[model samples]
Target chain A: MAKQFGLLARFKDTPDLFHAAEKVRDAGYRKWDTFAPLPIHGLPAAQGLGRSRVPVFTLIGGFCGFWIGLLMVWYMNLYDYPLLVGGMPFFSPIFPFPIAYELTILLAAFGTLIGMFVMNTLPQHYHPLFNSEQFLATSSDQFMIAIESSDPQFNTEATRLFLEEIGGTDIQVIEE
Target chain B: MATTTSNLPTCPAQAELLDQIRPAEHKETPLVGNKRDFPWVTEKICTIVESRVPTWWWVAFAMALFTASFTGVGLVWLVSTGVGVWGLANPVNWGWAIVNFVFWIGIGHAGTLISAILCLLKQGWRTSINRAAEAMTIFAVVCAGIFPLFHVGRVWFAWWLFPIPNSNAIWPQFRSPLEWDVFAVSTYGTVSALFWYMGMIPDLGTLRDRATLVLRRGMDETLTPLQRKVQTAIWTLRKYGYGIFAMGWRNAGNHWRNYEMAYLLLAGLSTPLVLSVHTIVSFDFAVSIIPGWHTTIFPPYFVAGAIFSGFGMVLTLMLPLRALYGFHDLITQRHIDNMCKICLGTGCIVGYAYIMEFFIAWYGANPFEEFAFINRAFGQYAWAYWIMFSCNVFVPQLFWFKAVRRNAAMVWIMSILINVGMWFERFVITVTSLANDFLPTSWGYYSPTIVDIFTFFGTFGLFSVLFLLFLKVLPIMPMGEVKFVMPQADPHGHGFGDTAQGANSEMKGGAH
Candidate 1:
């Protein structure tokens, strides 16, 4: 038999989900989360999460791309093999501006994707939550709150009762 | 859970009181119709992919595949023979190949404009159409790439355009406008693809779950054994296919937080990137000393024209799909009206550029420049020029009327004509200037061979084939994003406060 993973509770709709998350948060549980079909605007705040850390990665990638584009052009046109075209200078930022500018955007986009994947630790491809039939609805219509057994606050019976108290229906102790 | 009707003004006097306070103008057009909910939105979009192949899709796919074969034949012949197989000549060296390239690349811009620019501007309407539009951008870029790649004569030597350490000792010439185009087009394609895929992750998860749930819930007694077997096979394939790409998206709070931020950052990067693509494409001409192509207005003019043609292409693809899918509610009339307005605005800009170019030619008083402008409108290629003017400039003027804008059939026709006009636009610019250059002895009238004509037409077939496959497999709308904009998604909205059911639900998040 699969070991018990956590207690999963179903909320009726977005408002029910939102309020349940707030109650769960204030109740001092750490290893818990609310899942829904679409992003609720204030759910992150309710869940005690702050601003995402993706921008720093984007900034870093942009700077590197900008410099790399500029230097690559300089090396190719000026330093590596010098040539003159239409009596234009060996290189000017003006001519290579498009390349550098494009690279800035290109790498910045790459950074955002990378940062997101890293922050989310995605391509995980497996989690205990995947085992629950009810939890599958998170991407479609269902809204849910799951409290992991690993949390210090977890007690199967107590968590089930708490979830029910907070207007959660169909509470179940899902297993991995 | 049950705040369905009580939140509304139930009686006339109650409605009158509510209306007195509710600003009539404050009511934004609903993004979705029939007061849809999350599950319905997901089901509506997902079923398009999950449903058995429709008859029309089969018919369209057959035509697209048949048409795509011409491109395959043309390319094989071009490469096996030489560049001279086509109608490209000494004077008009850049002929239909360059014209088609610019036209297709111009069509690619609307996708990014809708996905990136509109997203940044908080235009909730973009959510319904952005998925298909982004797919169009990708397929259009693929078609755009084929021309320049084969136009180099030896398609094998195309790798030399990249700044890589190859057996060939030299690197790409960074100073060339063509080289700039390489980076610009490739970057735009990559970012647009990334944005499209990332945006679809949540929706892919939705499909994945549908496969799991539907498969688990056994079918009705109506299905035969063979039918059940086939359905099971498809569901299994879809489960793994979507599940793999979905990357185990849980719709968890932490995931959405980062996903949205990443999306915003990408949109920010793409806005400037989309503008830069056409601007750089314009530089390909403006940097050259050609009389017609040397104007400073080329960048802005080209961008506006690209947007006009892109919106035109969007309408061409969307009008049919929306009607076929019965997606009238999702793709509302407001979306069509908004797109028409954009076309009219940009068409005026393109027309102004056309007239302004002639004015500049007269103002500069250069005989060569003057001849180029005169030749475009009144010389050997006058027919092409007039076609461009009428289609791009004159036809789109119909959009100025609200009635015409609301009429999807009229708008669809205008959109196709806009596409045709823009194609001729590139033709007039590329051919007329080269056909009658400063030296008379080198001047020659350019016309495409059957190979050139077939290759260009084949691209449409290829685009349709790709898009058809996309429609058959992928969720065609950004279901997650669409739902995000619905009034019900707002936790602080009327449904969440001051109602009996809202109180029953204990909506504490609204307090935050």
Candidate 2:
């Protein structure tokens, strides 16, 4: 809590926070974010954020899992040590489909969890925002906007005025 | 109507809020009763975890712990003596162990159905109950895994089910249905846990915040005892403990964007995952060419029965907890009604599956199949068959009446009966089929030994203990998701919501 990290502003409610988000996006501030207790529908678009890249990871994991499951069956049964049982073909995909399918789901879930962590860069352990006691309420019953001082358009006085003009209350400079 | 319209405020936002609030032709029951607000939802759910344990909680926990100890001692004795202590004979090599396995795993389906399937369907009511239900799913799976692992007779060597390539260099039969079960149950356990924990993160943060707010004094000044000083130490642990597991969740919009995406994807993956688990489990019997088990309909039937039994278990757990905790607002009557309807619906499917099995046996004209069906209904195990039929089939039919469905006491009884019926259903399916097969000389009746009975009985204890711990430690309901379903959670709406706030305000003073 030494250097000014950003300008923090609290909004009255969701609609107010949502509108403020639109203004902040229009203001073209890149190093900024909005916080809410729960996911607000259409907030991402209002905040000028695109869809998440998590699905790509899930698909990649599923593809790898399916092939891995299938090949493992083949390797174990036919390549490594072939054994004859019930006069069935040694490496038939039909017999081993359940194993592969289960793996596909297993790995796909792994991918989704891993991908989400990667996308969010989570387990951050620390952030400048945590220093602001008022900001902690964002996890429960409050909505807030934080525009980082590192933004290219960082003017301390102007940014403070801009936030005040947008119906923000309890405006504070979060120190990092 | 004109006066009502004109009395509405001149503000357009206020007007739109009224229309949305009005009861239209498609009137639906209130999802959350008593009009609970966001903060109220968080406080109500979190305080249960934060406050001093109630006296009844201790009583219930002690009983569950006592019951679970039977399983612990039974398993130790089982491993020591060998699998022979159970009622294994010439025909019934597979006994109560397999029956309990299927029963426990089948009960887990409802949780997945509520959390994953209902989430996919956009069923908003699921928000209030999904967290507990998902926890039930994970715990039920743990109980289910024990029987199969130990029934292998060499519990220590259970790791051999997986293809880790030990010194033997030999591989498991990749084509075996039992092998498929190893993957399905393990994967189901892992993914269900992952889903349950992921959903809990935000709710955990809610708990963490409240716990962190006042570490010197416990959450409730009035409720804190002399032991509250001790609770402060626990609070310090909670702040960092829930903090670390909360994964630094600040409820930032960017994090939620990715989090929601992952949630939807997991739900998508879990749908097929849940369906496949029981399907593969059914294959363990169906592919084996056993007379009763060799049907094409086993997968769908098993899945339906699983859902039916799962919902029954949900009602069994939630109804008592709801009444004890005074969660009428959060877990409204509509929630109970809806679960009754699901139980009724799936119970019908199970009944139909039962009839269809018999129909196919007669229709197919195979002597073994015909004998299996007749013997199932009228054989030495006729008593079990009647129990499964009456409870699984006949008892649920009572839910067709609105009176029965709405009656909490009656529904609770039905839920218990439904569980009993389902357990017997599995017992009948596993034992009857194996007991009196093709050979008359080899056929013999299976009776569970003391160890077998105690082992199966112990699972209920194990399930209750885990659930009781969950009730005490975690936010039993998903507060964030429940808040998500409230009208005020809508982004475009004026904040106080139109529901009761606008209407009540306007009603108090017309022409505002």
Candidate 3:
């Protein structure tokens, strides 16, 4: 049997898309998403999506990098070889600040990148969303809402009518 | 009220009727063109990458390649012969190589200033120029990294600079600025490469999609086996390559939210790095005991000069290309004017630093420092010093005139002069301080050998080659970011409905 993908609706503009998102959220559809060419302000709130947790990952990465820098410098400079030059002391907090600061930033940047990918579940080369011919316009100048067929309340005919009522145009069923 | 009405030239009802007929016009200048719409932007920018390479691009590429090969030749000769092939002797051991290193590193600063700093400040003009500038930064650093790596003389043993466990268990000196430089430049290069690649991801998706369209159209009436195979290969490569990089960016609200957050944080992280990287580079000289090199003001002075030189190089590259590519709409007169203003401001700061160095040398009453300043202006290397002053200080002052800044030819000429002046500035700092050190007997006049000259020229070739190649491969402008600044980008804006209707029609027409 051919798998049922979802119902995809194209909106003419963002206001229409926002209103559609409100209706869909009110309809309590869990497995759905909105797409646009650029990030629309307040769209996430309109759909009632939860906040992302990438910042927490960044914080942890920063602290770990800070300690790694401090310890690496200490072990190498003081504990391991301890060659005294310019009559300066073996170990000091002041000397390692530059390396520590650099590491903190480097690790935090990596964390942000990794956390974003992890949270989004990206590098998804193939998705049912890509199966639609018109769906490519979502990355360009179009706004779209896709409610997966896997949603608990999804009905083939009823969902199409509901999308039309909410001002979605050119509604189509996506198949996998 | 009756008297006011009687004094009016026309009746109030008549005036009200006229006002209703003609609405007030708000004549604000757009950042780009008035006719620039979403499809126009996507088509225009992508076409640059999709089209065949132009004749001028080939000519430039050939020149860049010819010059860049000198680096290989020079390096091979340097490795076969010892460090003695070039000029490095008694007191003036730190010579042209160090000067070039500092010079190239300084040239890399403007990219970060445009991409990261201006981004934080919400400067929309940076969108058109940042991609190219960032590429330049990465390439310039590659050129800069070469000098220091070879300067250690035994290129094979350069790994000792890092803290890897060894049989001898000897560690690199942590307190030294040189060690800090090793970390700073490497970290800078890594972060810059990551940032550049991250920004290129969305544009890569556009290219991929465009390739798919072309492939699909070609597949409809394909003829030969060879053409079929080539088309399939090209399509597959673009699809997989873009797929991996773009990471499924659908411009979903949640994806953008996280992406924007990450981008902003990275910008914040890189801001301090801009100040820190050059400051540490400055410390290489300031921490020294040499009279002219050692100073409290070196950090800010070096930072200002770096920005000055960086902007100079940016203008030198951007002006000609902008004219040739007809990017005037995207990179407007205002953008050029703003960059010129920054160059002028930083140049003045550099000029002030020159004056203050002299003042401090006299005011502090340090004989070595006093002689160092006097010797720079009227000593054996006085010609170089005066050239630096004239180019760095005098040339930029031309920009104070509106006519000069607006004139592309004049700006280009001044930009080249500023770049030359900055190189000479580094040369004067490095050679002068070491040549006229405290001991008269140890002091010697330093001059570059043919090898030194070739090596330095080779680095420029290397930088140009990388940048030119980059221009061909990537979308030199950020199409996604540019869209954000467009008037029609806002969904709820007036006339958005009309714009959408036009876009829909255009999409439908293009689909067929």
Candidate 4:
């Protein structure tokens, strides 16, 4: 038989896809993924994806915004020009609080949006997962797991045995 | 393939149902008795609209409107005739005008806070009355604007507040508290208008669909053409308007994520305005060397008082509105519970401020400050002070009990009481303190003339007229948001999954 580049395994149910993907991962194959119409919990671990770092980015953005506001206040009222109103300090932190709060939030939001876009590697026109018609079920109602031949551990006989052991049904191999 | 095909059979059927085109013949008339058991929502909603305003609502609005318009018409006469027609004397420059200004502005706060703040927290109960509350905010702000504009006496020169370099080559004093007022109020109006419009767009589409030919024609003129106008409008909106604002929403895809971002942004934006607006308003009092006004606690105190009065007004508006509009489901006991909690919290803060003011007056050991507090409670104008205490402090205490908080009738009564109390609190601050300043010889009693009273009335009338118009025009609830918040619409744990994967995969991979 001709060598296939990818093995496709449809799930008995959504949960089966996750279990099969987990087995594939434990078998030490990295070039494997699980796809479903909706997000399946714990599938990220099954697919070797890590947790997000967007929150840290947001915190940094917020900090930057706070300092920027403080800097503006200092520039406008203290360094650039100074006016004494009611004998209060030129760079009063009390009045600067609202501006600082606003800027912090603004920066945090911008960071979140940008961070999300950058992390997701989005706006791409094409993906390998889009190649198979059977895989189109990933956008509708079915769950599917695909293990590419790119994996170091992916041998045709061994992968087929691994998928069948983990409750994968309607399995097939595909090539480019 | 050993997979059972039975479970998968339904998918194709659903897909066929989705793709099947309904004939236009049945479009104009929905099958009348298709689901005979489903209670008639159309009739119910119509009955709600035609129902008389609750007796209490009319009485309350009439009384409040009388007072509001009295103050309003009084200001008009002040402008038309002269400021001298009113009771503002020297040293006591800020009088009922300041009192009304603060009072109305304070009432405005609860509306936005209820709408935006509660929405952010996912307190779903806010949907029903948020429209009315937002409308109240706009109206109260308008009423608040009248006093300050006429306070200058030369009302026509209001344009000078703008940053217009004039023939006199004069620019507004950027440092002045009044100038800050100009900025705060205008910014607030613009932001509120945008928020309100954004909220109304989807509901407006819903209303457009259900409207009669005349109403449809009217809405179509502004929105789009009639016939298939609403369908076209909604489709376009769902495709484009929601395309951008929806933030990569696909169906209910990432609905909550987008809402969370937009809502967080709004809350983050408005929270500052809440603090800044009142702080700037307080500056008008503080910049003056009035011993009582020149206190550091003024900002927090004013903010607390604004929130206190604002929630009070919201309760006052909501109690009747739910009954009138048949919105009991949307504005539930839980919403009232939260609002009552706010009122209780803010009331305590105001009460604490009152105590702190007296303590500080004694601590400062300044006779002017001491006498101001003393005279406020025990002097000739002590009536206003007691009314403030009883209304602001004592009345809100009823909310401590779950029963009282949940009880609509009692909520209405307390809300009105709080409004009265807040108004009197402003009265005590503006009139009593200014009237009895450091110089005993310069001290004078300031009673509002009929013109002052009339201007106040006219303002209430104006507010009511505007409110009535709003009811007729806009959808009272945000329909799009309602669909978004429903349990069926929640796709992922946080509405961030495949939708996020497609649009934001690059960002999600970032190391930071």
- Stretches of candidate 1 above 4 Å error? B1-25, B218-227, B495-512
- TM-scores of the models, in the given order? 0.93, 0.93, 0.91, 0.63
Q: What would the per-residue lDDT of candidate 2 be over residues B1-512, giving only the tens digit for each residue?
A: 00112474789998888778844432566577765566777778888987888999999999999999889888988999999998887799988888899999999999999989999999999999899899999999999999999999999888899999888888999889999999999999999999998888887777777666766334557655766667677899888888889887778888889989999999999999999999999998999888898988999999999999999999999999999999999898889989999999999999999999999999999999999989999999999999999999999999999999889999999999999999999989998999989888888989989999888888889999999999998889887788777766666553333453333433111112
Could you arrange the candidates by DockQ from highest to lowest?
1, 2, 3, 4
Candidate 4 clash total? 39
Candidate 2 segments whose C-alpha is farther than 4 A from its true place: B1-26, B216-231, B494-512
Candidate that scores best on TM-score: 2
The alpha-carbon lDDT assigned to residue B508 of candidate 3 equals: 26
Report the alpha-carbon TM-score of model 4 versus the true structure: 0.63
How far does residue B324 in candidate 4 sit from its true spot (Å)?
A: 1.3
lDDT of each: 0.89, 0.88, 0.82, 0.65
Worst lDDT run of 10 residues, candidate 1 chain B, spans B503-512
Error of 1 at B156 (Å): 1.0
Model 3 lDDT tens row, B1-512? 00112434387898787667742343644566544666777777877776678999999988988898888888888888978887988788989889999999999999988889999999978888899999989999999999889988999989999878777879888899999898888888888887788777678767776665556556535458887887678677776676677877666667766766677777877788878899999999998889998999999998889889999999999998898778888888888998999999999999999999999999999999999999999999999999999999999999999999989999999999999999999999999999998988887999988888889998888898898888877889888787766655544443333333234443221221
Clashing pairs in 3: none
Weakest lDDT window of 10 consecutive positions for candidate 4 chain B: B29-38
For model 2, the DockQ equals: 0.51
